[model samples]
Structures are given as structure tokens and as C-alpha cells.
Target: MSWKKSLLDWWGSAGYKKCSEKNRSVLKAAVSLMVVLFVLAIGVRAEKSVVIIDDGKELAVRTYAGTVADALAVKDIVLLNNDEVTPSLDSALVSGMAIRIDRATDVSISVDGRMLPVRTQCRVVGDLLNEAGVAPGPEDEVSPALNSAVTPGMNVVVARVVTKTEEKEAVVNFETEQKYTVNLPQGTTRIAEEGRNGTAQQIWKVKYKDGIEIARQLVSSKMIAPPVNQLVMVGSGLVVSRGGENIRYAEAIDMVASAYTHTGNNTSCGVAPHYGVAAVDPAFIPLWTKLYVEGYGYATALDVGGSIKGNRIDLFFESYNEAMRWGIRNVEVYRID
Candidate 1:
């Protein structure tokens, strides 16, 4: 107030009234410019209103700084190497401007026998894999699930699972069947039908993990061809006439026959060796059993010999010359029931 009164008094003085109109106009213009400069200075120093979103948290800030970087610096917010910032740091600050910061997390991915270390801002595991350029197949197995939240230092594993169908062919064995008949000679057998092996197909489901087999299951089995059963005809018994006598027997055996004379040794059953007596293995024919020979006459089993085994018989002859003459022959033996 005192300065304004003094300046007004001097301007209205008689000496000052003598000034020219051009000088007065110059003075008025100078005062107006001074007032405008003061107003501009005040506007430049005014504070700006801004909002900072740091890791999903909103912070309302009134900053006197000029740029976004300067505003964050004022708040002592430091940016890391992997951190993401929007509305870049160099941009000029404006009233009500929004600055966002997305924090990155460190994680590791294990896939296809590889370890990949990465830093990402993705929150979900699936999104992190996508960002890392790792794609999982439909049948692949993933650890910690794709929808789970991503954590720091987490290790994600992907296992490749595969399933395959395998077909194999195998041989099917045939069965044998026996049929009894009295039409054929005793101890004789004939094949009525020949046995044949058939073919079969098997289907298996095999599962593999990382190129290694994990499980195998048989899914189906089908016969390609039915097997043929073998049919055999076996002789039960027969009646035959030898030396004008009819002999009915239960079983017959085709055996090798040899002749033996007296060796000054009695039979094992304490009987003197004589004609119509045969030496046989007790396992094949019991002692004192009735028997008939084809080339030789009927006889009884009264002795045993070490050389006489299965399907072999020793016929007794009265003389050495006769025993030599009947050296060895194949003959049919019949057991009377």
C-alpha cells in the first residue's frame, strides 16, 4: 500500500503531468508485461495430480515434477530389470495421468528334457508357458496343473504320454480225441482225422511315457481259424482161431520174440524150464499168466530174464538146435481174459 501511494503521488505531480502521450503509453505497456510474467511463473510452479498403479495397488500422488520418471523418483519407487512399466518413464506428466507397473517373477520350465530359466509377468502357469513358446499336446501330462498360479522359482514339468494299438498273430493248438473200436486188430491204431493248428489274432493296448513303455493290456483276442480235432481209432479186443482153437482175448501187443533153451537154471518161480513156458518181464506180464504167440504155440509166463523188457518175450524150446532155428521174429501176443 505505501509503495502504491508513493508511485501514484509522483505520477499525478505537476512535473509528471508535463510528459508526452508517447512516453505515457510506453510506461503503461511495460507495467502490463511485468504483471503477465509474474502470472506465468506461478503456473509453471503449480503441482500436477497423478495416479500410480504399482503391482495392482493404486497410489494417488500430487507431484511437482515434470515427467513420469521424476514422479516415481519422488516416491522412491525403483524399477527392476524385468519389471514392466506403462506410459513410459520419459513421458511428460499431465494432470490425472495413470502410470502402471507390472512386476516380473522368476520361474523355470522343464519340458522335453530341457530346462528353461525365464522371467515373466504372467500370473497363470498356462499363460507363462505360452509366453515362453512352449506348447503342450492334448495327451501330454503337466505338473501343478495349467490353471494354477505361477510362483517364484517354480518348476513346471511336461511329460509326453502316448498310446498305441498293437496286433499280433499266434498259433492255436489242436486237441486229440480217441475212439474205441473192435473192428481193428488188437494193439493197432489208425488216425481218422489229421490235426491242424489254427491261427489267432490278439490286440494289445500299449502306453508309453517319454519313449518308454509304461503299461500293456490285452484288449481283444479273436480266432482267425478254428482248430481241427484229431480223431484216432483204438482196438479194444478181438477173437482169433489158431491151431483149430478159438482164442478170445482182451488185449494184444506186438512184441519181439526170441527162443531160449535150458541153461541148467530153474525158473524164477522154482519151476523146471520146459516147452510152452515163456520168460517175460514181470512188469509187462505177471508170473503164471496165460499167453499165446503167433509163430509159437500157447504158453505160460513161469520165468523172467534180464534182457526181457517191455514188448519183448523169450520162448522156451526143448533143444538147442530148435532154439537156434527160431532166432528172432516179430510176433503178435494175445492175453486171454
Candidate 2:
């Protein structure tokens, strides 16, 4: 009757009953508030739409958004530093409005597994591959065709490169000369002391990548034809001297036998001879002996000049003026010795 009875009596009082009802209403209100918050959250989440970017598609995307940056972020699109974004980040994004993104990237191309360097502005895998510097390998496959467009985050794969190599036959020619003897005069003949055959051959090699020539080997080499022999004759007879004493005399003509100047020196004077006309020995021939020089005109051995020495005869002109005018040159001397 003590504690339990007292607690039951207090609960049965009127103020306690009002307090309990007030507490129950407060609980109901709190539950209702939580439900509203949950519904509000669900509605806000539903407003965010997910965008999909397919491979080989344009970087410029169309969205019903209020800003360009917001639309790109929503679609999870990432832009490279060198990529161009049209309409700017803060530009309003309206329905049917395109947001173009031009991509600039460094692409590596490979031909027959050899790497090549390239820079690309294409957005799709196929375009970038084509822009890659490497030439297409035979039997090679690209993930996208050459005409296909490009897209972001797409990886292009190239497959199996087949190469065909074939050996082509070609010829190399070789030549050599052979010497033999023949008689100049009629009824004379000499022996063919030495002779050699000319050789020629064909070769074949397998060609590899990049049209590189390799595996050079000689297939066949043999003398296709014999070289023609050169002919030479031996001198046999000499005739006796039939000319008179004045023409028959032979003597030595020395350099500087008389005084003659080297008119033509280091400098070029067109086609004329620089030195005085070279003369044969006068002792072997004779001075004032009236001789016909094959290349040069008839000249007299009148003047003894210093330059005239050593198998040389100086011809004198009536005037020193004429001697200066004579050019140095080669002439055949018929001895009026």
C-alpha cells in the first residue's frame, strides 16, 4: 500500500492524462515531418539525369541545361588541356544546342610494329588512328574504319600484320679485256698471248618490310661471252738515210742556247701557247734549215735564244716584235736535218 499505491493514484489524476495526450500529438507531428523530408529528398534526386557518351561520338553534346560546365560535369566528360570547348564553360545550355569539344592529342602510330609520331585533332578512335603517322600494314586490322568518327575515352586496337616477301631474280654484268697480237702489214700475224672471259649472273633475294632489299645472294655466275682480243704488230724493216748532207746532219739543240723570254707564264692567254713555240734539237736537225712544222707554220732557225736548249731549237724572227707575237705550243718537227 505504500509506493505502488501512491504511483497508481498520481497517474489517474487529470493533469497526467492531458500531459500524455499532448505527448502523443507531438510524436505524430515528428513522424509526419520525417516523411515529408524523405519525400523531398527523393524528388530532388530524381531531377538529376544521367548522360551516356558512346564511343566514336562527337565531343560537342546537346543538353537542356542552364550552363555548359554543368552539363559536361553531369555527363562526366573530361576535357584535355589542349582540347577546345565551344560556347565556353559559363554559356547557357539549351535543348538542341551543341557543345563542341575539339581534342588535340599526341598519337603514336605503328607500321609493322615500328612506332611513328603524330599529332591529332580528331575526336574518334578511327580518325586518330588514320592521323597516326604509320602506314597501314598488310593484313592489319583497325578497330574502326578509316572513315568512322572519333569519340572520347575510346581505345583503338590494331591487329595482326601479315607480310609477304618474295625473291626476285636480277642480273649483274661484268666485263674484262683480253690482249692478242696481229700483224699491221698484210700477211703478218701474231699470237694471242693472254685472254679472259667476261662474266654475268642473275641474283634473287627476299624482300622484307618497307620494301627494304635484303638477303642478297648470287644465283648464277658464268662467262656469258668471251671478250674480243686486242691486236698489236711488231716492226720489222728500216730504210737507209736517202737525204743529202745538209738534211742528213743530226745534232743536239740545248735549252738557253740563245736568249728567248718565256712570254707566256702562269696566267692564261686563251688558246695560244704561253711559252715560245717548242723547237726540236737543231743539231739533230739544223738552223735556217727551212723545215715544215705540222701544227705551226714554216719558221726559220735564225735567232739563238736562251730558252732554246735541251732538244729544243730557237727560231728567230726578223724583228723581236714577231718573236713576242709567236705563242708557245706543240709542233711536229720533220727534220730538214
Candidate 3:
């Protein structure tokens, strides 16, 4: 049968007769009222009730004909790059729809050994790790601590600090020093012993953060090649006696001594050349001075020669053969006045 005939049959069915006249009348009035209200609601169906959540805060609001972005603008909510939204701002709004915005904050982070440019919606350091998808062990370190509050662009460091002891060898520089001694006469010094640099073995406690060396502390140090202190002996005080007379002198040095003789001619000081006359450097031992040598006895410094300059002295001997015997010899000479 046709759907039209079936509907007419249902209207005349026994079930339709089961209702009382009074009840039927009430039902009929209710149906008529519902139909009229439904038609009126269709004309104003553009308005919707949307729930907005911003940073965990919820606001139930009614909006008139616009997208989700337009609805949030009416509430003066501005979206930033760090802010997040569910169902995106461009999506159309529907009645009784939930719009969630999880706002992100700029945060600094150091993971492992490197600093990271990060932005997250986490509110605490502990939550930050979850947002970063990092699970820290008991030995790992966290800056701003794990339970501390997090703010925008705050410093947060996660380090794995480990310690170990190590042994190392190092060089030590030797020291050079002087020693005053009365054994040697005054105004002379000599290096008694040469110094050699030393070596040492050391134990160090080292600290590494995230596999990078952070610090080291000396635990123990032992000398391997002990440092040798250079020793210099300096003369302190003295007096000497020579030529049947007591003489006082500041110092003595070696000199190249030679001999020249011309018994009859005069010397540079107008004194005739004699066995005791000595041509000496006036700058070192002045003319007309009395001096004594170690091997060659006493002499008078009463003459000067062109070749006699600085630590050089020409002595007078009785004969040329006698002078030739003393060709050149380093002799210790004393200064006496």
C-alpha cells in the first residue's frame, strides 16, 4: 500500500482509540505548541553557546554568528605565538562546543650539555621535563630545582654530574738561590751546585657535568724527582799579608802577566827601568803602586806600556832570556796600596 494509505490506516487504528478524549485534546495542544516554537527557533539559530578555556580557565559565553576567532575577539582575548588553541581559531563555532587554549611560555633550558630554545605550556620545572619528554634519573641535576615555579624565559639546567679520581704527573720548576759563606774571602761568588727542575705525581678529584669536565681538585701530591735548589757561595770577609807587610784588599782576579826589560832606559814615570818596575793597566792598578803576585814575588807599578791594558801587566826581568822564560802565564795578582 501507499505511504499515504498506511498513515490513514494508523490514524483509524484501535490504538489510536485507546486514548481518552480529554487526554487526546491536551496532547494535540502540546504538539501544536512544539511545532510553532521549533519554527521560531530556526529563524534565530545563528546564536550558539560556546565554552572557552584559556590557560585552564573556563568561560561559558554566547556568541552571535561568527567563527571561533571572532567569538574570542568579542571577549578581548588576544592570541600570541606562544598561545595554543584547540579546533584552531579559523574553525566554525557550534552550539555547546568547548574551545580550549593552552598558552605557551618562552623558557630557557639546558639539556645534557647544550642550551635549548624552548617554549612550553608547563607551569613548573617538574612539568617542564614532562613537556620536554625527558625523564631524569636520581643522579641528574635540575636548576630552578625540579619543584620550583617556572616563568617566561627562566633559566633551567639539567646536568648529569659525576665525580672521579685521577692520577697525573706534572713538572715543578727548580729554584736558584744564593748562600753567604765565610769560607771564601769577601767580594767573590761562585755557583756551588746547579739546579735541575723536578717532577711530581698528583691525585686529582675531577667533576664532570653532562660528560664535560667542570672542575678538578688536588687530592694529594708527591714529589717524584725532588727539586734541587741551586746554591751560590758568596765570600764574606778576609785580610791578607804579603811582601813583609800587612795588606787589605777588596778582591783579586787572574791576570795575563808578561815581562819586558831595558835596564838602562827610563820608564814612562821618569823612573829608570829596573827589575822591580812593572808596566800595568793604570785603570786597574794605578802607577807608583806596590803589588804582589802569587808565584812571581813583589813588584812596583811605576811604568805603563801601550800593550798594558786591563788585566795585563808587563814586568821587568834582568835579562831577555829570563823574560822569555815567562812567555805568558795566568797569575793571581793582589791589589795593595
* Shift of residue 283 alpha carbon in model 1, Å: 27
lDDT of 1 by residue, 222-286 (tens): 99998999998777566889988987665678989999998999999899999999999989888
lDDT of 3 by residue, 70-106 (tens): 8899899988766888988898778888999988888
1-49: candidate 2 lDDT, tens digit per residue: 8754765576577755767677858855876786698876655444333
**What is candidate 1's TM-score against the reference?**
0.39
What is the full ranking by lDDT, best candidate first?
1, 3, 2
Once fitted onto the true fold, the runs of candidate 3 whose alpha carbons sit more than 4 angstroms away are 1-46, 51-100, 111-115, 134-142, 158-164, 183-187, 208-214, 237-337
Best by lDDT: 1
Clashes of each: 0, 24, 0
Which scores better on lDDT, 2 or 3?
A: 3
The residue pairs found clashing in candidate 1 are none
Question: Candidate 3: how many backbone clashes?
Answer: 0
lDDT of 1 at 184: 66
